[model samples]
Target chain A: MFGPFRLTNPLSGGLLWKIPWRLSRHQKYRQRERLRKVDSIVATLDTALARQGESMRKLVRWKAEMPTEEEMLPKDKYTVFDRKVKRYRKAIHKLPKWTRVSQRLNPPGF
Target chain B: MPYFRITLMRSGIGLPEKTQGVLKALGLRKRMTTVYHPVTSSVAGQIMRIKELVDVKEVGTALNKKQMREARRPAPGYYVERRGTAELEPPQ
Candidate 1:
């Protein structure tokens, strides 16, 4: 009878036996801590952008030391910056977002 | 128990409604929404339904969206422990 069963079977591995394995690899313990760190950094950037508002453009130009792109952006939320050029472009986008929140930050200005 | 790290590589768009529904149910709204679920028959079925649209790998623990994103992001590889700007300032 498999009534109200909680079967425990030791799992076997295929490859990569060098790496340690876990038994009850639940999300609550292992993942949440790493997620919290990433979320905090992104939220910090978002807050900085929200406070800077319109002055964000000049701030980005200063940090990047480059002219801003005049073209309109596509309607995509995710952008991967693989090179220094793309990083500059993405910094242009992040400027407004970071500056808008930067105004509220009392940190020593750069 | 190992969890599966499912990343949607191809879009489920223009696919059958049932297949699309499976993707939606997995919290995969776009081409790269990586979701983690415990290794169970139900999750397996979901993955099997849209297997062609995704790249699956079994990990020891489930990784959240942010953690997964950070994991895939390349390292910055540099840090500043001291500032030279203060050294340039005039003495009071």
Candidate 2:
């Protein structure tokens, strides 16, 4: 009687135990995928920073070519340029903080 | 009221269906999406189910979607300083 009961137990070596094992394996795979995504976000942000830097340089060049401060481009144009520069600087400052946050969440070798 | 600031740091892909359901219930449809809920045991339990996939913070106030986006935005770097057409005229 004991032998038969032991054979039927879910914890006993059988197909039933595979369910939890499979579930855990899937979880691990998902975790890895998520970690990879964090890295991808960091990479894309780096490229964004490079692109923003180029645009900022172009804006500075245009500003330098102007004859005088009073004769600078229209107010709207100046505002737009200022906005872009501010956005770029803000992104540059924020990206590092985001990277650090992500790193803390997943950690290296995690 | 105190709130939990939950940001999805990871996706639920390839995970068990139930785990994915928990994320959806939390209103986290994509990575980096954040949501806030008042501190409660029910919400805490939901968070625990997917705790590995999110970063949680406690805050005194919750920010709406627009405020959250603006918080991430940067400021403009320069001011007009001054504006006048007379300065452009030829010196007399």
Candidate 3:
């Protein structure tokens, strides 16, 4: 006979998120779509400002500096540099609300 | 005078209250709902707070609720040009 389930998280004793170590193909596809959508939004905003002969400081900065989705490397796309994680790299999905937050930029010299 | 046309692309069902408050402040209550605001740093900052959940575009003018709905409506594929004459039409 089996005992208890013995599948409890020591810290919370609640539902624990079993985050995977690597990104799945579907997840990678979705992440790509999200990044591209943000890029297009920025592009649309920039064009709209040009039409009106006006510009927002942040928009200008974004257009000037932010890398497009196509420009990012595969490693950066799937994992982010984290000082706490082993080897200073962690899967992007491990972050809380990862889908609802943009983790595009990594710390320089990381 | 350009305005930011922001549309909520994702739900805030399980997100933090602060994030939900930001979306509420932007007048986005549900997914695919759009709101427009003049391009200001304060408004931009709010958008930044929930950027991953929205799709933003810059437009010269904002459309009203009716216009937004109309824009989303699909065109009819076929039109009835002739009036029906026979009560019992043969089935093809």
Candidate 4:
């Protein structure tokens, strides 16, 4: 036979516990919104980068297999690929650099 | 000074020779290999060449090989709370 006694729950109520439910709900919502924005940005960048990488790879393969001077293609053809390469290079440069420091960590003037 | 924390995320197995050369020049010999370099135009150019194959972050400090190794090491699950007196006993 066991004796019965009511056990008081130490964690049932506290000032610290009450504040977080309201504060954390709003904080979590904001965090999720920020994360979603970041995810979309990253997804877009990844797609663009992947496309650029594929085009660059194709160009490299074409250049590698292209004819030598003795068996050259037309001047316009060579120049077209050259222009494409230049454009790809420029686009790569134009894409934002992946350096993103947290605002809190960044220096005052940076 | 700002340093680039570059990790090779993909292999250069089928990539162009020049791309592979750039990876080698960056001191990244294999996938997941990391290297650090001072932030400079030259380093930026090198990274641009293989940007698609790398993950990069600008960090405030560069870690040496030993420090990098230590950073990747896992925490020990157990800790010794007391020392044993086995050494104090005579050889038996």
Ranked candidates (lDDT, high to low): 3, 2, 4, 1
Worst 10 residues of 4 chain A by lDDT: A98-107
Most DockQ-accurate candidate = 3
In candidate 4, what are the lDDT values of residues B1-92, reduced to their tens digit? Answer: 66778888768776678989999999999999999987665665676567557777767799999999999899989998866787687897
TM-score of chain A of each: 0.27, 0.30, 0.82, 0.28
lDDT of 2: 0.54
* Candidate 3 local Cα displacement, residue A24, angstroms: 0.5
lDDT of 3: 0.82
Best by the TM-score measure: 3
lDDT of 4 by residue, A8-109 (tens): 343435433332212234543443443343333333333433443423443344236533233432221112221344332221112232122111111122
Residues A3-67, candidate 1: write the lDDT tens digits.
Answer: 45544232243443342222124422323333233334333333334443312443344335421
Enumerate the candidates' DockQ scores in order. 0.01, 0.01, 0.38, 0.02
Candidate number that wins on lDDT, 2 or 3: 3
- DockQ category of candidate 3: acceptable
**What C-alpha lDDT values do all the predictions have?**
0.49, 0.54, 0.82, 0.53
User: For each of the candidates, what fraction of the native contacts does it recover?
Assistant: 0.00, 0.00, 0.52, 0.00
lDDT of 1 by residue, B1-92 (tens): 56667778778777678988998898899988788876555665576566546766666777776887798898799898889999999999
Q: Candidate 2 on B1-92: residue-level lDDT in tens?
A: 66778889868887778989999999999999999987655665576567557777767799999999999999878888677887898899
